[model samples]
Target: MRLSIRSWVKRVTITGSILAISLVSIGCFYEQAARSRAIKDFPAPGKLVDIGGRQIHLNCQGRGTPLVVLEAGADTSGSALWQPVQEQVARFTRVCSYDRAGIMWSDPAKGQRNSHAIAEDLHKVLRAANEQPPYILAGASMGGPYVMTFTKYYRKEVAGMVLVDASHPDQTARLAQATGEPASNPIPMAFRALAAVAWTGLPRLVLPDAEVPELPSQTAKAITAYQPTSLAAAFAEAAVFEDSLREAGTFRTLGHLPLAVLSRGKPWSAFSEAERAAGGLTREQFNRAEAAWANMQAEEAGWSSNSTHQVLADSSHVMQLERPDAVIAAIRDVVVRATRANATP
Candidate 1:
């Protein structure tokens, strides 16, 4: 059959769309089955507290005052990210970690996923769980701002804070100006593609988040199992990351509050080889980024007069996991200082 080129192109387009639809259906089925299996295999370790109509996962341990509330960063396995830290901190004082809505076992949340919204949800979960105040908050990455927002709202309740390689509110603008590159995800297109097919469960096979070797064995297992299911939620949070930063930016300062700003010394580790290749980021650009990051961390430390700023010389962004000793020391230091202040009065 001698078909016109226009007709042939039209047919190909229709056929391609049909094939895409079929693939999406198959992917959806695969995704649902995988989700079922995953839920069965890895149930929520903590109890689900009813925060209004929806419930969020909250895990608390130990038995003492000045509770340590840990907030995990963007695209992380929420509470599992703090297992190692929580375990140790729990020995001396009460510590808790929870998944934000739509992350891990928590109920799906609605509205803008900004830091303020996240902090509000955490407050609800804490109240629902009967977890009292006098909290020492430890937030890592985006979690830094989440905890900061919490401190802002519950000022009197907060005892201290620990920012673990925390995100700076102005880093996006500052880094862009510093490096001559727009602030962006390491691989935006790739992430978007994965996010698109995330429901079809293709990324689950392609980007299997197995054991995070840097973390403890048990913690790694929990994160591995929960992570695959939370990819969409993680990316969703990443999408609104700038909003979260801006919301956290409103936090004027911690005053003379006991605070610890733990910055990563090995900033280059944050920009991976793949990231450099994908973004065409050069050594000079990365060096500029590191310089900006160091300066930003110093500024974050200045948020408090009674604050200690330390750069973990051997650590990366996930310094809590890479250098747990340093993270533990920082959190414990804040906790100790906070406790002393409380005792003095």
Candidate 2:
């Protein structure tokens, strides 16, 4: 007894749907198991202090005057991201790092994830943790804007700043103009997709270890454990990027504060052959775009009356990972200058 065509099609569709649902359920179960394991294996190494209703994770080390505060890049886990640089800075002055709300071990908060809100959160966490200032704030990538916003609102608290391949306020527009590409962010969508898939435990199977740096076993495990949460928080932040950029623009100057801008000196060779071809850009065009980016970074150094800009020729955008010494040195320079300034008069 052969089935009719309509019956056969309906049977096939139902079978496919059932199979898909079953696979998804299995993936979700595995994901939950992984999450449970992560929670058990990796606990927060720092203090989780209540800031308003939400808890923020604060990690402080070393002991000295003029504390150093490290801010991680967009979507990055804070203290873990600063591991290499923070350890060395701790050798001299007290240094601290923290996870912003909704990242890592930090509890989620209700608000727009713009620079202003982020900076406010940082200020609240620091005060709650009893860390005093004049602080030497170091920001990398998007973290640059948050630190700058902090300096703007709490001018008296900040002693100095280090911008490590920091994002310029005009970076999006400038890059768009330079590359002849429209300024837009696909990060939110990308992360949202990842979040959905991650819940299915697909990420555990497909996520590569290539991007994970050589860190302590515990740190590595923690990072892996928190990837999904970090991605979601990053998506929130990325979604408000334009607003964040506008907020950053309101900050006019650093007002004679000590500043160090570390720019990436490498070329734009990270673009694959396929990507470059897709963009319809010649090699020369790519080089020009990179030069424009470096120029914009140099301009960021000029925001401070007393500022110095250095191009890290041997490094990429993630200079902390590539050349931790350079970042440490910049922080040291600003700290020494800040110390000298404090002693004078």
Winning candidate number (lDDT) = 2
Clashing pairs in 2: none
Cα lDDT tens digits, model 1, 16-81, are 999999988998898888888877877888899998899899999999989999999887578876
Report the Cα lDDT for residue 141, model 1.
Answer: 90
Q: Estimate candidate 2's alpha-carbon lDDT, on a 0 to 1 scale.
A: 0.85
User: Which portions of model 1 show Cα errors greater than 4 Å?
Assistant: 1-23, 185-187, 216-222, 267-279
Would you list the C-alpha lDDT of every candidate in the order shown? Answer: 0.84, 0.85
TM-score of each: 0.89, 0.90
Least lDDT summed over 10 consecutive residues: which range in candidate 2? 206-215
**How many clashes in each structure?**
0, 0
Candidate 2 Cα misplacement greater than 4 A, ranges: 1-21, 188-190, 267-281
CA RMSD, predictions in order: 3.1, 2.7
Candidate 1 CA-lDDT value: 0.84
> What would the per-residue lDDT of candidate 2 be over residues 44-101, giving only the tens digit for each residue?
8889999888899999999997999999998645568788898999999999999988
